[model samples]
Target: MKKFWLSLLSIIIPASAVTFEDNDTVVLLGNTVIERAQKYGYLETAINLSARKKKLKFRNLGWSGDTVFGHARSYFGPPKEGFDRLKSDLTELKPNVVIVCYGAVAAYDGQKGLPEFLAGYETLLSMIKSSASPREIVIVSPPPAESLGAPMPDMREHNKRLALYSKAVGKLAQKHKLQFADFFTTLGESKGLTDNGLHFTPEGYQTAAPKLVEALGLSLATGNQLQSEHARKLREATVAKNKLFFFRWRPANETYLRLFRKHEQGNNLKELPMFDPLIADAEKQIEALKKTTLSLK
Candidate 1:
């Protein structure tokens, strides 16, 4: 059974592109776009089903409002502290593949901020390479903002800036010889894709998931397959796993748990690692479901 899946993956994944091998751990890192994906699970589901890697592990390390500078991740400390935290998490996870998506919030700064954004992005990539040393890095251009009429505020100008940033991202990917996923261009101004011209709705993620798989040079899973019972089970397991990880990494009342105020609730710190086994168990469930789904097909 394992050999069958391996052979299928080899056939589906283009040799010229980055590939996912069995047991490869993939970490999704970025801003609101990446972070919110965990809630829908469509993107992860598509990747898993399309790649057909039974043991492929996924970790969502997305931080809402995050920048290449790690501002959202900084918590109560300096931006450097947030950046350090990102490095630390990557080092701990030691993923085989890292998919990075940014440029949304940074694009708001427009032309004046372009240079700084690019520089920060370069530094962030270097940090990932030095810290985690992943086998492959995939840079994803931020998805374009939608233009819902009336009360949604026009996003045409913002999308223009986004396109500029996306172009820069593509060039960076080419220069570094890395795989690039251009959501900005692929998902340009779709109706019902975004709720407020920015964040994706569930249906939007469903629409974008196949595009992501295509951009990564992998075969696309059919809508029927994605909606199947086994697939739904897999997605549920994926979401459950992501929630466990989120709590493990970003616990409630962190200032009291493991920071300066740790003296008060630090005793609970030992409970953090307990989620590791739970996450592993959830992955096992996902693996089993993948096999069951494939066998049915």
Candidate 2:
């Protein structure tokens, strides 16, 4: 059991920036947008598919309605406690690369909260740097909300504010010498992308994933060969691997598992560690499928 645990922990390792090394552990941190990404799997798929030469690991730590100040992650405690939890989580992951995405929700407050938002953002960046010391940090600006016509407020004005926030994020990235991806500017018109003004439709994430990959100086294997049945299998395998990883890293019902309420139902927490082996199996399957897919060409 000891040896097994050690091997499982060895899953995450350092990687290169221009392209991923075989053992890279990439962690995605942000808000609802990032959380929702687990369902679409476009971003993770793009990364895995684009990384033809190596296998990479990904862990998404997105919390719905989370802020730069760690609002959503705080549970019943203060935001500071949530911030500390974020730090601890990153430290545990020991990621080689971290993609930080935030700002859309903060932008809702408009200009009134921009300064505080930026400050908190910077602090969050610093904390991440201090905790994980990742090899590369890529900051992604939040996507603009669309005008959904009804209960949703006009997103034209919201988008203007979002631009400002995105610009601020870009400036911070430059100042900190980190890589930057501008989802805000790149997403362009909302159109049919979002169901409401704030969140994305599955199609929206799929459409945006490639742009993000491009922005990060990565390239996808897009050709007639990729349209084949084997290619579809590879895509499915990628999604399965990512889903297993998501559960391995970010399990649900933490309030009764890892938090204050654990005293009541913590015994069931044994199930959590079971995800590690499952994730490993999925990753190995992905590798096997990738080899078969590529060999066919």
Determine which window of 10 residues in candidate 2 has minimal summed lDDT.
8-17
| Total backbone collisions for each predicted model | 0, 0
Model 2, 50-163: lDDT tens digits are 778687878888889999999687777777888888999999999998988999889988889989998998899899989999988888888888897878778788789988
lDDT of 1 by residue, 137-238 (tens): 998889989889898799999989998898888878877878887777667656788889899999998888887777677765555777788878888888
Please report, in order, the local distance difference test score of every candidate based on alpha carbons: 0.86, 0.78
Best by lDDT: 1
Backbone-clash count (model 1): 0
- 10 residues in a row with least lDDT, candidate 1: 8-17
TM-score result, candidate 2: 0.85
Q: List the residue pairs that clash in candidate 1.
A: none
- Residue 275 lDDT, candidate 1, scale 0-100: 95
Model 2 ranges off by over 4 Å: 1-18, 150-152, 223-231, 292-297
